[model samples]
Target chain A: MLTAIREKVLAGKRISDEDAMYLFASDDIFTLGALASHVAYRKNGRKAFFIRNRHVNPTNICVNRCKFCAFSRSQGQEGAFELTIDDIIGKLGKGQATKAKGMGKSRSPRSVHVSPHGFSEVHIVGGLHPDWPFEHYRNMLSAIRKRFPKLHIKAFTAVEIDYFSRISGRSLEDVLRALKQSGLGSMPGGGAEIFREEIRNRLCPEKIPGERWLEVMETAHRVGIRTNATMLYGHVEDLADRVDHLSRLRRLQDRTKGFQAFIPLAYHPKNTEIEGSYTSGIDDLKTMAVSRIFLDNFDHVKAYWIMLGEKISQLALLFGADDIDGTIIEEKITHSAGGLSGEKLTAGQLVNLIQKAGKVAVERDSFYKTVRVYP
Target chain B: MITQEDNSRISRKEALSLFKNADLLGLGMWADMARKGLHPEEICTFVVDRNINYTNVCINKCTFCAFWRDADDADAYLLDRETIFGKIEEAIAMGGTQILLQGGLHPNLDISFYVDLLRSVKERFDINVHGFSPPEICYIADASDLTIRETLSILKSAGLDSIPGGGAEILSDRVREVLSPKKIKSSRWLEVMEAAHRLGMRTTATMMFGSIETPEDIITHLDAIRQLQDRTGGFTAFIPWTFQPGNTELEETGRVERTKGRTARTSKLRVQSPATAVEYLRVLAISRIYLDNVDNIQASWVTQGLKTAQVALRFGANDFGSTMIEENVVAAAGVSYAVSTNDIIGAIRTAGFVPAQRDTHYNLLRFF
Candidate 1:
């Protein structure tokens, strides 16, 4: 079964759903990784990417209160707080000033394409605040764009966009377009937890349904807003559930060709209602390799270092991951769920990790444009 | 004249070269081929056993070991006969067929203490007592003024079944001199295994890499094991596990050096980074390819976790090693991956192999 899949992959043909399932269940991880690496090399030759970005989670007060989310808090709950637009900009401004000084000394002058704020992207995703108006999110994006004109502001998930549409009584396209006009460059892949309706419901009952999330993404794609796709695995999901999720994403990508990358989020079991352990390195690498091999239309697969820790993310490069996400100034969602990786990584450190893995470290913007390549 | 057998085997130079330059997945393919040649069936094996640490008090305080304690340490303990019996009884009730009976090398305990410990367990329950690693045996023999052969004869009569491959971190004396100066040298450890093999006792071989040793040291360890296995075909398996640097003195020294803003090279004790999964799989596959004389290669889920262990099945490991009803050594290092017997079986089946229950000698007892 695996050999046939390998042949298809080698012959530049797309593998079927059954083939992806077999690769997931197969113990031949080395071969799977090798095949995935072959495909990844064809797409990206010896180049791995990392972005100099900051993750600005504006609020944790969410109305959905999904069972698997340890990062969300109810309104007025203890530890529940919302960051105003000023607060978000203040954080990003301070972080950028400090990082710019560090980058000036370490980064090569030729390779360091320092933005006015030192970082090329600012990743913004937060809970759906119960009280905040949809205009508040739009204003937040516009404010960040005003402060740092050069920064690529990649904000909001499909679920958040869906919430925005509901709260504003607007259609999905209207909300996405409004945000885009307010400086939303792209969307981060989240809230697409599992496309299998049964598992998705059990994992996050109050969250938007799988179909709604897909609809929201499809709407965003049609509006010319490119986004990444994600599947949360290792929590109340099986191989078939994962295969179903990937098949749905692949189908959507075939139609829209809007997914810039596929990021497989490893479910962290800390502080969450989900009762399970962390995903093993074997499973993490296998997921990366499988996503890269299966998502033929997607140009990149990101090993989100915030979830995979430093070492496994480096190994994921060989397992078909060509992007390590970025130097996330601070990450909250995974940490709230007992994420063991450091909250932030320096740009120099990110380059070192990719280089040590025997790859050409390419600094990328939010849309994965090569800003600078560190050979 | 070169024979087909010699051509089939890789030399120390070739092994070292592979360690230095071989592509990880390429090495894995070679290893998977090697594994298929040995284990043609779609079967992987494991043992349902408990690691009964009779004592934690030791004199040889190796830096890499977090399980040892001083004789007077507040937490140090020596299990009594009844306590040992109770644990073995619990193990048997849980369908455990063997007990990995090992402990620290106490300076006070003589050969009689070990003999009685084995005899008492064998008298009450019919179980395989895979007891006494080479370090413990060497310590016991030296303390009792007996030869390694004499010590083996005494323990065999009392019910010692076989030896485990603990305390063989790396066979290079240069590594041993730095990692554990007080423990026996590489030759003495091999001598104990040789004596046990001569007595018709099958043992296992292990290598704990990812410490300060270079690629040369790893090949040296593999070569030593291969040479010994050639003389005595008593090794049932070769298990290569990464050194877990959690709560151990080694990690502490590294931390202290980093805090002082000094590079690792400036200090006499170079702090070792924990081995990544890539290095673990590379060494594991190479072990399978290099030790062609050895029949089985066991994966260390106890350190690498179950997922990597599942991957190890195709990387030349034919066994899941053990269910480990109880394990303390690696736990002391702050890395304890607890999985039940059913979990091992499930993982094997999920990895697309038949999970079979095996005894100490690799003889199949049952299949799931």
Candidate 2:
């Protein structure tokens, strides 16, 4: 049965939900590996990839107390932080330069003031705060882009957008339009749990509904801003639910064609509303390979270093995944949730991870432009 | 395969048969080399490193892990600075070399916190700073409002040796979306690691599989790793393990509900036992054989433990991974396995190979 599924996958046939179950239960590990290999070969070649960018987490104070959260605060938390526009830029330059130092001690002293190539993008995302109006977002984004026009600004996840729209008394369309006009270049696909309401209901009760989040992404895509999609796993969600999540994303991508990458998030389960969950390293690898097989529309499968730690991310390269998202200057959402993914990694370190995996490391822009080849 | 009795291991004919199906053959003369080495290398190994999760009270709480808690949790804590130093000291005194230093995605711990921690360790003893897994880096970035590179730079500058190759579970958005939905997905992980590699930090790689995927999925994981390895020659090794599902909500009552809590954790260790671990060993060997580019094939005594780990040597593993001073993640999964340098050397000697201490790049530091 597993071989049949493998055959189907190798033949480029879309694997149905039923086929996944049979493959899961069967004992044909090699055949399944072969099919996955076939898929990888047919699509993404062996390329260790990273994005040269930074995450600009605008605020940590949020209204939605989702089950899986270690970063969100109710505004009264002792250590809650919200990066002002200046603070965000400050973080970016410092973050990138810091990463560059890892590339070499000499790399820094020469270009500390100007920052040669450390920080990547100003990844602007934050908690879904009702208090912060659209103007706040506009100001933050406009300031960052205006200051660092060369830097790609990937701002706001679909869930945050939904939150902002409802609070701003604006439609999702209006919200996106305003943000786009305010220089929101792209969307970061966060707050997307399983598309199935069953899983989302139990795991994240207060966040946007499954369909609404997709609708927001669709709108962003329609508005000409490319975004990435992500799935939070290792929680209450099931295999079928995971499959449905990917299938749904695939369905949407078949229409909008907006998603630049598909990132499978490894649950941290550290300090969140939901309790008791963890994903094994093996599970992390398998999920990535499955995402490559399942999400046919996505061009890149990112092994974000922040969540899945470098070791698993390095191993992730072999599982049909291609892209690793850019360096994050200051990522708050996950960190606040009790994850120890990493303090941060430099481009040099990323190249090292890929080299250890025996793949070529390529730096890409937010728009998926290949920037530089490390080796 | 070098042994005559191992003729039953794999045939060149079988390897040739696999070449067309396996993607490794398409690159360079890997097929020819693999043909000589019996395709798939058929041997893989892992290293045993202590997880020493110093503290569970983290500020960065992305939604995919269950190993941490608030500082107030009954089990939450911050290992006394002395205690952390003492653990490494003890490991070093006992012949440990590598220390996987990681903590909760703590947000309040600023640049000075790590600088102080790293300086303390560097001053205390000579140990490889296999610390600051990427998530920790991202958390530090967020806490300090620095980019990953900036965080890495500060850490590296402060006697921070190398980054631990932890946290990278998968490199696909679909899987990350459902699993960690909020945590930086696959790409961010890759981005940071690449940045570090460019910075000259020799890191390692790893993968956790079997939770929510098909076999084809595993290949995708391999593809992602392979691609990165082709770029910067910074990563030193790759380790893969199964998720420990004890306190985890899904495994507790899911389809495998029959699995008892604590007891099942032990069984899960065996899930990657000598047999499975050896299969992975073969895979590791195959990785080396395939990635002629990569040099070391490590034995994972950490996840598989000492006994089975020793057996990995004959299966094609070369390096006896790290002499971890403390390990916590696997312990969280409930595996009680820790070994000092003496233990590693003893294991290697028993396995008929000489033991050698090595740095992040696998360059032999000294063989006692």
Best model number under TM-score = 1
lDDT of 1 by residue, B1-368 (tens): 11124556888988888877888788877888889999999799999898899999988877777788777778989999889888888988988899999999987899999888888878888999998899999989999999999999999999998999888999999998777778899999999999999999999999998888989999999999999999999899999998887766677454331232233433455454677667888899889989999999999988877767877776778999989989998998888766899878877876778999998888999998
DockQ of each: 0.26, 0.03
Query: How does each model score on TM-score?
Result: 0.84, 0.56
Best by lDDT: 1
Give each candidate's fraction of reference contacts reproduced.
Answer: 0.36, 0.00
Tens digit of per-residue lDDT, candidate 2, span A1-375:
665766678678888767765554443333444455457667656666786666666777888777778877788788777767687767765654454444454544555454434655667777776577778888987877777666667888898888778778899989998988888778888889777888877877888888998999999999898999999987887788887888889899999999999999988766777766446554666677778777766788888867876555665676666776655655666776655455566666677667645577887777777777777
C-alpha RMSD over true interface residues, model 2: 10.7
In model 2 chain B, the worst 10-residue window by lDDT is B266-275
lDDT of 2 by residue, B1-368 (tens): 12123424233343333322444213212322433353233222223345467778765332324566666667878887888877776666655566778888754568888898888888877777778787778878887889888888889988877776677866667665554455666778888889999898878777665455444445555566667777987777766655555444334342232222324233222221112332344344444443444555566666665544544454345666766555565565555564556666665664445666665656555655
Model 2 segments more than 4 A misplaced: A24-30, A95-117, A338-340, B1-368
